[model samples]
Target chain A: MARTQGSHSDITGPRIREAALALFARHGYAAVSMRQIAAEVGVQAGALYNYTPDKQSLLFRLMYEHMQDLIAAYADQDQTEDAAEALRQFVGFHIRFHLQRPDEVFIAYMELRNLSSDNFAQIEALRRTYENALEAILRKGQAAGAFDIADTKIATLAVIAMLNGVMTWYRAGGRLSLDEVEQAYWDMVHRSVTA
Target chain B: MARTQGSHSDITGPRIREAALALFARHGYAAVSMRQIAAEVGVQAGALYNYTPDKQSLLFRLMYEHMQDLIAAYADQDQTEDAAEALRQFVGFHIRFHLQRPDEVFIAYMELRNLSSDNFAQIEALRRTYENALEAILRKGQAAGAFDIADTKIATLAVIAMLNGVMTWYRAGGRLSLDEVEQAYWDMVHRSVTA
Candidate 1:
């Protein structure tokens, strides 16, 4: 019975998160409720408590896992010592990774105000960890004389912000193919950072 | 008496907008109500209706006015035919204008999903007008061989997205003065568009 219950939790965990993310993305986090999430997941409110203590925990987990997954996915990519090549890879990777997770990306930016102080700090730390990955590349490139950057930290944020813009208006069947879109941005990012 | 009531509306209209903007920024539009806005404005719920028909109308009016103010302010700036100089002015103007109204900027992006479809279309048209202003600069620069851009529209969006990033993390008296910060971004923007 214990094993069966554990298995159930393992399955229900992702479903709860999926439901919470969708609802939070559609209706702002403040407007979504525990019961609503449970309803979306086809579970009772009590059963949701079994999975997460409350809605905030669920939100934190979704955001935390999104960041964790992002870091891990990027880490799994091949690393190169050449700073320009690495930065190029980053431009492509950042755009592609974020484009695939629209709801998570939306919540990550939109719901930061709703996080508890502690939760916000933890998420911010994770975000910094992800951002540092890019900042380090900018610093390495600057040290190696491959890129001309005013401030590595600002460049890092600017690059990410510019890439994140893709999610706002990009549609698969839009005027430009995804490859064309990515190439255009990569060219601009490359020029922006390099002499 | 009629003139006095008209003056009262002129004063209360702005107060109502101020209260609604603050409330919607703090709480999502879906979660905030006419009654809440009325309380925030220190008026009765029924009195709120006199100022605005409903919560949705208030939201549309706030968003409408923000876009209108943005376009009007940008239009009032010194016009220059030089593409690089014009682009620099834009980078500075976009950052400074948005930084002053954090609430409006936050709501502009975050609350788009909350706008009624008709309201959304009008706001989007206003936004496109603003974007076209930038795109035209890029096109002129490219035509004159002043800028090396892969796609003028894409470059327009990329530059604006990059500049909009300042609103996310800028604070006065931080490591960089506002001038330094703007210079850094302007350098990046200028480089990205020009050879």
Candidate 2:
């Protein structure tokens, strides 16, 4: 079907991205088509091209923006020398961030292979930067003797894994409040790294 | 292309499945076509139907068999009353199983939603059974006062989540041996749970 002209507006970009995120999360990147995403956004197939050059670019933009957002959010937090506090901030921030932007989180995790090699490397580097931030906190904690961990790198990965796993089963209206989930995860993290 | 006719040989089914598993893992389930799988297995597309009714069934079979194999392996282990030892066994088994069967593990985790509702339920039920095995160990540890967990269900989920995450980054031929990875994971799990 011919896409209506002028349908690509300021709002359409985010709308298309949002629709792509959901579809990618539900059916994965390879299975989802530009037409399906366009339909979901209530636009014509050709109009989607006005927003994204191609499906790959659309997927890349979604993942790239999500990673940038995560890095920004973590950067905005108050700097603290206290490793435990820093970790708590990281944990709390991660849970809240993923919860608030479930679509982006889904896209970032599920559509890595869909991006071109350069795009994949770009997104992966951003991810590593975020991960290294947490690792720095863990290392500091170890130095201060406030926490005991066998391996800081592995521990960082473990904590992030546990937190990211929440997206797999967490629902918006689930019985456990996000606060409770965060607390439970914090407790687990505390136990894992503490002496 | 038309599928070549082959006698209903026992090896043919496994061949088709093995080829499908590799392709699915490399390109993802939705991106892999039945014809590609047939070509990989040296058969025509129609010939694949003799083994599997459709592409979805092929995916389900791989996932289903992986779970079954996991449960069976654990079942063969000698009975042990020590919760920690049993938990260690579970972790070791899981890591080794996934590492050895990367294709199956990839499909099971990555292409779960591709299954029909009925098939999804069956896979989910098998997964719960595996999860229950871990939960039982946690419950025993809690009862013995060896583990300090606020919620066994949450703790079990957290522990499993962290353990399962090893697959995302683990390489089959990496410098770190599977035994070493298992040991590292076991150390983390032990430290996380033990009081």
What C-alpha lDDT, on a 0 to 100 scale, does residue A123 get in candidate 2?
98
True contacts kept of each: 0.63, 0.46
Q: Write down the worst ten-residue block by lDDT for model 2 chain B.
A: B1-10
lDDT (Cα, tens digit) per residue for candidate 1, span B141-171: 8998999998898888889899989988999
Q: Name the regions of candidate 2 deviating beyond 4 angstroms.
A: A1-8, B1-8, B172-175
DockQ of 1: 0.62
Clashing residue pairs in candidate 2, if any?
A: B3-B44, B4-B44
lDDT of 2 by residue, B29-62 (tens): 8888998998887877887887887888889889
Q: Candidate 1 clashing pairs?
A: none
Tell me the tens digit of each residue's lDDT in model 1 across A134-157.
999999999999998989989999
Q: Give one clash count per candidate, in the order shown.
A: 0, 2
Give the TM-score of chain B in candidate 2: 0.91
